[model samples]
Target chain A: MLKENKKELESDVIQLVPQLTLDCVIFGFHDSSLKVLLLKWKGTEFYSLAGGTVRQSESLDKAAERVLMERTGLDKIFLRQFHTFGNVERYDREKIKKMLAHLIDPDLWYERAISVGYYALVDYMKVFPNPDALSDACEWWDLNEVPALLFDHEEILEKALHALRLELSFQPIGLNLLPEKFTMPDMMRMYEAILNKKIDPRNFQKKILKSGIVIKLNEVKRGVAHKSPFLYKFDPEKYEEVLREGGLFFI
Target chain B: MLKENKKELESDVIQLVPQLTLDCVIFGFHDSSLKVLLLKWKGTEFYSLAGGTVRQSESLDKAAERVLMERTGLDKIFLRQFHTFGNVERYDREKIKKMLAHLIDPDLWYERAISVGYYALVDYMKVFPNPDALSDACEWWDLNEVPALLFDHEEILEKALHALRLELSFQPIGLNLLPEKFTMPDMMRMYEAILNKKIDPRNFQKKILKSGIVIKLNEVKRGVAHKSPFLYKFDPEKYEEVLREGGLFFI
Candidate 1:
């Protein structure tokens, strides 16, 4: 029954007068770095942001989640709808025409397609990157080291980054990026990675500590350095309460 | 050439997939009351939110501007994209199918669709409401007396109102809502309407006056019961700066 309904919906979509697609800018923090999940085309050097079309029966949010899950074996991550890019030039008409001339038939090329862009933050170690049949491989590229991506994906990524920065100013973000248990230095490094700027270590620690969102565990980093930093974990219930109360601090 | 391109795009969409549409919730302030723009259906008791389909060659933002202009005959208003709702059940599929079966043909009933919602704040008096072909009349309804709207519009309006409340809390919002020259009471009333609660008159004045975002006019309101309140207007540039600096106070 589900399959039949899916087929019916697809046929309905084909009969409609406009097309909708979903694009994702998946960001991850690792090794004191901010990286974006990108896919390289199967037979060409062309790379692009991970994306896919929405099934006729699927909600736009479901499409984004499915795209992320397909491209990278991760689920239940922090995903958000950032912006919908609808400029006619967004598809690069000329380039699309050229690509379609060789790839898809010209008859299928003129379809009016609009895409919604969503951004997701995932734990780097938790995701197993899987390249789809259309792509050569999926890999995490340091945001600063991003190669030229196909279409307007670069612009979409930039917009996603701007949204992430804005969110960071008021939200507690590193929890999704760091391991369940980590040292203060580890958390600080993740912040530095996401903010993409050098922050005073002492000031960063003071602000975060004063926020009272992180709880220090009776543990410390093993080995290395003259003094082992204390480990900490986020208190979800308190953090959410702070978020709701509009008392979350951002600098 | 543009017309031909449009036709070709439309045909292509008919052969591809359905595209998401956009609906705008434009709220305005006037007569010491909050108002939202609405369009009444021509032959039925149904009322629809201001809406338009996303053109193949247009962005969502552009589509919103077009819809706003066409519905209200107003341009260059303060507009912002708030959120997009894509619940699978957003449309009453059963109702649509039944309507099409009775009114048109079943073949024409099958179409996949989703809608993105945007909210804008405008000056109510500046707009000339012009109902479209499908609509009987266009008018501003007081927020307190909104009629039952079609589809999931009431929910959409609620979401937009929530976002507006948050904006009022953190941002200086009266520049678009109030006239070029207005009194302090005008600003306070607008705030009270958005906050939906009575604020201490003296405390509100003290806080706003100290913010330095409003400039006192050498004028005052005329024909009042008691002492005429002093007139004041907001400084757009300075208010924007304060917004950026996150200096707006909210409790």
Candidate 2:
């Protein structure tokens, strides 16, 4: 089965667009810090974002969506293309050839490479990552503790974060990284995680009330020390409209 | 000389990255409308943005800047890559083959293509358009009067304009499309052109004054049918800083 799979992979690789790859920077809010989805390559010290080469018939955006779904079981989330990484020496071609010597032709592997970077904000609890043959593990890594990435992925991630931050200051996008029926405090945490700065709770509540992106649910939480904050869910129609024409940011 | 230039172009075409092109959407503000730079292909009824194939060694961004300079005779403009067009049939293969059959191998000319779109705002008076071999002329067209483009350029231009509008609402970037010295009325006109709506002059003046991106020049303009408006220049140091850090838009 493995041999047959490898043969199919080789055929697909031959059909793939040469020297181009699609790397996804998937950001999710979990615990306190904003986290990114990363894959640990099998039998290697390097890790990378959920990424793959473009197929012959599909667009780069489609390839990115396919890769994100294959790695993290995510679908229907909008992945925004932030930038393309095309530095001549972004990746060590010789080192990549050495690493994939058993799997691919070194000459083919060493072609001057370029990759487009796409990013999406997904709810941390919803995504269940499943690594493929190239990697042994897929997990969320805290942005602060992100270990050394394989190539210029670290730079790509940095740019993605910067784009996200700029949007956060103007658009209501942090909700995508929060679960439905979340408390105001969790939403605040998500904003803080993306902004990397503390947002006053009162200020956030006031701004959110004016933004009209959130709908207050009738039910309140029971598990709390003093009082339970009312749960809220995003108004899908309003959110989609705002997503197209951005809303005022809480900041 | 024409044949020799054609031969050199063929060589450069051979050195280009397979199936990938770079198209630039150069925007300028003149009179009262937002304008875009476009090229007229020699034989076709269609026109398109100033665009070219990417050389094998240079990055896509570098290729875009080169195309911009070669076409407009302007340099030092920083273009931002807004999107990539990668539909399988983005450009008609049969049409391309018929167009380039005499110059290139039809097999090579008809490869499935993708394009990266870059946009820049430049002063209209500073740009001197130059047409290359494949094109008969290059000119700035009002955004409303843009003719039917050769391929997906129409779509690409639309996306670029959308990005510029989004940026215009938050970033003080429209100054690049203006003359170095201009009246407050012209500045307001630039915003109206970009935002595609009339702005309250009083409000715009209030915002620009508070933003401190513009300097009150010692000289004032003597114009007919109106009181003399002060000539203003961008505070180079502060404008550069706002450009780097993005100033508040005069929306």
Candidate 3:
């Protein structure tokens, strides 16, 4: 394992895109709460989004997918590149420098560091988070309760959340966060959770139904405090068509 | 002048962001056609988007502004980061290597090169396009008729156009492209050019009016074949409010 880990960090890695890193902010919705997958470094109190150096021969998109799969053991997910953070100071602060000293020379790292932030919206319950060799534990942190993250990761996470919220306002990305089949109320709860606000139930229902991207499933909520809501599933074909036609317009 | 240029390339230039570059896709609406800023390499048939290497200390946004000002002699333009091109092959082709050999060691350049793509919507007549030290000319090529561009610039241009068109469909970014006081027909023409499709004048007028983002300027077109259309300007306060609320909702 020690040899394997050292080989992974070797300089002769084919087509390695040096001084470049990829960070994934995997957002998931579970138990009516919005959460993000985070990894804590081994034997340290510091935490960060799963990050990987880009391989030289791979496109940023492919690199992002590789990193996501390596960290969470999940693939074929839609990973959106929200922003590339290029502030040279991102790894220059003394505390962050100390946190990263073992992994990279802070002086050289700060000289050429730029990170592309990619985000994935996944069903939290389905994902099996796996930490990389450097970290021992990976878990989901509630969007509202993330701890102090290492380096410039907290800012990256904030921007990822902002990008996700902006897209959710219009794009039907909840398909990535929700289960295959869920009650309409569950769908509504997820949206409310992401938006961090309560929406008018009647208006929300009417708008979604009018959008025609969701199909009524032949099921209902089995156990609930209130009357069970009708089950719904996203119509992939209609969803793509609607998304192409500027997505679901949320007013 | 040669000595001055040599000194500019020296390593002593403070705060240079090594291995990182900024490329701008300056989109301008002109003669009812959407266009982009392109720079032709000096003594070569090759053309590329105006690009600049990043200085180490300044933020990416500031570097983008600096590059835009150096290329177009325009300042205070709102340039949006659309994508980051980190493909190792972005400058790996033989022809591109030769074209850029004098500027960078192609081997080293290919190893760590990553470019941040930015797009700006500016009035066509407002910019005075200027070539950099390596280019002989800078001009706007019609988005439909752009010649073969150098490096992966063509891909960058396409993505920028796609981003611009997508945002134009919903966002009131026309605030940047249109003159302060313009007629309804002028605004409609700009939209038609961007969408590459004719819009029904009546429906377009109705929608813009309903958005409540533009304020009538109490003026009319001076001379036109049709009856002079009412002139208007984006209502600053209302425009900001609408933009903050996620811009015009064009269905």
Candidate number achieving the greatest TM-score relative to the actual structure:
2
Q: Each model's TM-score?
A: 0.82, 0.91, 0.87
A139-221 per-residue lDDT for model 1 (tens digits)? 99999999998878988998898777766756677767889988878887887787787778888788888877789899888
lDDT of 3 by residue, B1-251 (tens): 12344456564655455567888999898887888899988778889998987776677888899999998788888689989987766755777667666664555433456889999888788899999987889998998899998888988988887777766766776877888888888888898888888989889888888888899977887778888888899987877786666656543
What tens-digit string does per-residue lDDT give for candidate 1 at B18-99? 4466889989898888999999875566777887766655667888998999987777777777777776688687775453
Better lDDT candidate (1, 2): 2
Interface RMSD of the candidates, in order: 3.1, 1.5, 2.3
Task: Go through the candidates in order and give each one's DockQ.
Answer: 0.41, 0.54, 0.56
Candidates ranked by TM-score:
2, 3, 1
lDDT of 2 at B117: 86
In model 1, state the lDDT of residue B56.
57
In order of DockQ, best first, we have 3, 2, 1
- Could you say which candidate leads in DockQ? 3
| Full-model lDDT for every candidate | 0.76, 0.79, 0.80
Number of colliding residue pairs in each model: 2, 0, 10
Off by over 4 Å in 2: A1-14, A91-105, B1-14, B91-106
